[model samples]
Target: MAEVAILGGGCFWCTEAVYLEVKGVTKVESGYTGGAQPNPTYEQVCTGETGHAEVVRLEFDPAQISYRDLLVIFFTIHDPTTLNRQGNDVGTQYRSVIFYETPEQEATARQVIAEMAHVWDAPIVTELAPAAPFYKAEDYHQNYFAQHPLQGYCAFVVAPKVAKFRKTYADKLKT
Candidate 1:
């Protein structure tokens, strides 16, 4: 009934767009975390100096979608096996990570990763870390994909990820 899930899976734009469509997600904030810098900017994160991964802070109603369901959708939308990269975007900031809010969430993330890893050929490299401070991204970056779907990056990269998420989590969508 109550929980928070923070995840970093590739570009925050792609992850934000996908989670926005999930029914239980009451709020989705694109941000930076697991880094050293306080209030790191998108540019700073892009530079990878903050030691923080670009992340999304999700506020969801667990009654509608369990944290476990969020983990499944996250795994589906991003390539968790790759290290510090998702497709063409490469950097430490782009690393796949899950910031668990509790011991239960941590366990669930690990269990899901283990199960899904067996289902896929590649080893899962998604890092499971304790939740840390999350600095919200720039205003324009908040909803990048939906705001700029025609943008080259969005058209070629984010759209496909969103479409895949929609198909995969069809039952869990917000409608």
Candidate 2:
């Protein structure tokens, strides 16, 4: 069965690009969640008024890759210690967060957070919240990094993260 995991680790493009290459991840969709505005637009979220974070919802085969493993990859790729920012991306929309769907997922998230605490010098500030309504981002946002690998932001920001994932989790990548 395919299990769901919603994660906001900076920009969805960065997170989505990395997970797309994971062997067990069946699907990755860039979207927005944890906000009040229904079906928020990228422009709206970028303004940071919607309270939504750019997130990627992943469907993965747990038998192939455990949930804990996914969280570990997530924590490694992004700066979880910084509040409401990632690199040059600022505001609440760029915050690092995990919207867990079940009690098991919640527990795993908390456990992962604690373990990640030892890896970083500063305290991890990633939000572990209950899964909220997820609004799919615009069609253009889906598979953005793959489609725009040469684009400025994708080249400078997203590509480096993907490269890091490729190097660190080379065995976990799809054939």
Candidate 3:
């Protein structure tokens, strides 16, 4: 069976690119979540007024890659210590968060955060929240990193994260 995990680690472009290479992640949909708006456009979210975080909703085979493993990669790929921001992107929409679909996933997320605390000098600020309405991003946003690898933002920001994931989790990457 496939399990769902919605995570916000800075930009959905980076998160989507990383998970798309993971061995067990079957689908990664870049979207907006944890927001009040029924359908938020990227522009609205970018303005930081939608209460939504740019998130990637992933479907993965637990047997191949546990939710805990996903959390580990997520925390490493992005800085969770910075609240409402990641690097140059400063906004609530870029906050580090995990919207778990199941109790097990929630527990695992917390456990992973706890276990990873010592690795960073700052306290982890990643939010643990129940899954909310996920508004899929515009068609152009889907597979954005793959589709726009040479684009300035993708090359300067997304590419480095993808490279880190590949170097750090080579065994878990797709063949």
Candidate 4:
């Protein structure tokens, strides 16, 4: 069975783009979670009033890629030290967070964050919370980087993250 990981490390587009290249990730969907709203639209989430963070729902084969490895990749691809922001994208919706579905997931997330803390110069501000309702983003938000690779945001913001992942984790990339 495929295990799921919900992560919000700034824009979902950046996270989705990098994970899509991982060897065991079967699917990546951009969404909103960790919020009060039941089904927030992208615009609503973008407003930062929804209390939701833009997150990516990833389905991965654990036999091929451990959840720990996925978390490692996630931490590396984004700046978790910056609270409520990633690069120029700033807002509560862009905050770094991990919505774990189980006790085991929560423990793993904690361990990863602790381990990652030493790597960063500043404290790891990534939030660790229990899984909540995940509202799928609009149709246009899905596979955004792939569909609009040449778009300004994708070309500039998301592309570098994908490139860094490919370079840093070449063995984890799909053949």
Give a tens-digit lDDT track for model 1, residues 1-175. Answer: 5578999998999999999999989999999999888888888889977799988999999889999999999998989989999999899999999999999999999899988988778889999999999899989998888889999999999999989987877898887
Steric collisions counted per model: 2, 0, 0, 0
Error of 1 at 142 (Å): 0.8
Worst 10 residues of 2 by lDDT: 141-150
Q: List the residue pairs that clash in candidate 2.
A: none
> Would you give me the overall lDDT of model 2?
0.96
Distance from true location, Cα of 109 in model 1, Å: 0.8
| Full-model lDDT for every candidate | 0.91, 0.96, 0.96, 0.95
lDDT of 2 by residue, 83-164 (tens): 9999999999999999999999999999999999999999999998999999999999999998999999999999999999
lDDT of 3 at 75: 88
lDDT digits (tens) for residues 88-138 of candidate 4: 999999999999988999999999999998999999999999999999999
Candidate 2 Cα outliers beyond 4 Å, as residue runs: none
Better of 1 and 3 by TM-score: 3
Candidate 4: 10-residue stretch with minimal lDDT: 34-43
Candidate 3's TM-score reads 0.99
Which residue pairs show collisions in model 4? Answer: none
- Residue-level error in angstroms, candidate 4, position 126: 0.3
What TM-score would you give candidate 1 relative to the actual structure? 0.97
TM-score of structure candidate 4? 0.98
